[model samples]
Target: MNTFCLEVSGPFACFTRPEMKVERVSYDVITPSAARSVFEAILWKPQIRWRITRIEVLNPIRWINLRRNEVGAVVSTRNVQQAMNAGSGYLGLDIEDERQQRAGLFLRDAAYRLHAELALSPKANDPLVKYAEMFSRRATKGQCVNQPYLGCREFAADFRLVAASAAERPAIDETRDLGWMLHDLDFTYPCAPQPRFFRAEMKNGVILVPDFETGEVKS
Candidate 1:
């Protein structure tokens, strides 16, 4: 089976059931890229192929934010162990739960843009931004304004994924606002969600990445 790996680094936290309090927690993970892609397509398209295998954390634990508004505080976990400890802080939740919920933010954001890009203009180079703007409008409903966090240090995640056969993935519908879907996701913050990713290959391998360019360009 074709597979890819995803690396995501950022603060992770869990919200109180229905409270959604932003917490300070950080972590990192490397897992099957297919799984990451599938998680990305979660609310957007169920027809997509990709399943998470395992998730490994890499970093130190730390608390960052505790906001509860449109731009909730962004936090990062020191490492997997810290995240696990935070997860354990909760009664029935585990470390993986925290990671899933934290990942939900990125997944929702990416999925929303992916949907808009295919619907409005698949040819657009920056579909994610376009979709994010669209959601910002709707986010005003619950006083939760969808603020743009592109390059915003406050809310950012460093993640990578591996996948195969992009053709197998289904296109997203533009007529929908995936922001709400993300908002509805169980990992709305403070609530630990089950992990959907895991480790793939331990050691890194060298690759001769090709620099193919038919046209010559001047710097």
Candidate 2:
């Protein structure tokens, strides 16, 4: 299996904590789910999926607070279905009326080096090289299907392909147990997303991800 290396960074990021009820609070580092989303933004296919192996934190973690206005309620699905059925129904949210002020604790000046491998889905028939070459070309040319975001859609992320030789960038020297971090969500049920977690330990600024499917921790 070929491992792809990428360096993604942004001014602000919020991998929102699941425990937070209202105000947005971010994790110390990027979540694996968010990391996977970044790669999918660059190149994605139904035949293959990304599995993050490791994350190297290059910059020291920092935080900044911000208060912003956003809508509180979503347009009900019933309203959307009605709109589709009637050709024209109320499918819009009155932003002015639903607007509420919320505070967010977000990361600032964040940067990380991510390593991931592609896992072939049951639908895959093409060789691995085909997908590897496709990803290399797109990453080299900075081509993406859609703009990649750090955590929220508003905070855009910048990325680049890191050559194998240049992939030796050193991570900061730090060690801490981050408790149980949300690895990703199980989307088996399209409507109801289930959260998954694993014990996260950042040693020497590097977080080693486990095989999420097998429940085996990496040594």
Candidate 3:
């Protein structure tokens, strides 16, 4: 029952994990609390439990008014053939090009919708509030009850995990695993160290936070 916080901002979009095949994408503007809850829905925990308690938007919520860029409509030849294949299951590369292009158009439209919603709101000065309002509006407009498109300006996630047993936990230096890589140069060495945030536990779930500051990790 522990709670976490997430803050999101800047040209943000949410997509299901690559492994989860899905249809009918939706969109939403949400608060940290709501975001956390949604995140846990996709990622959850038993040994390491976390929930989103609150969320704050850091940038102006601009609803993207996106139209299909003609360039995007051209599905790769490979994708078209695969879409017609029978063994590809739900996710066939054939639809990738087309789906990707359609996604781009949807994002553009969603961004414009967000911006328009915020423009009419009196609290537009507060980017977080504006984004939340926009999300709520989209969620309602899209009639997306379980899932919706999520776009935020800047998003932060505050989380907690079960503290390792103080005694069993070794000193930081001694705890180093070969998984951590010091640098690209180190990759040439015997073994690369893993990230400090890497977790060995199987029960933990990840929260999706907007990378507004970094401008990386697109939806």
Query: What's the lDDT for candidate 1?
Result: 0.28
Candidates 1 and 2: which is better by TM-score?
2
Residues 139-163, model 1: lDDT tens digits: 3232222322212334444332323
Q: Which prediction has the highest TM-score against the true structure? A: 2
lDDT of 3 by residue, 140-165 (tens): 34333233225322222222221222
Superposed model 3: Cα runs more than 4 Å off: 14-28, 31-34, 37-44, 68-92, 96-219
Alpha-carbon deviation at 159 in model 3, angstroms: 11
Q: How does candidate 3 fare on TM-score?
A: 0.26
lDDT of 3: 0.29
lDDT of each: 0.28, 0.90, 0.29
> Candidate 2 — which residues are off by over 4 angstroms?
165-168, 216-219
Candidate 1 vs 2: which has more lDDT: 2
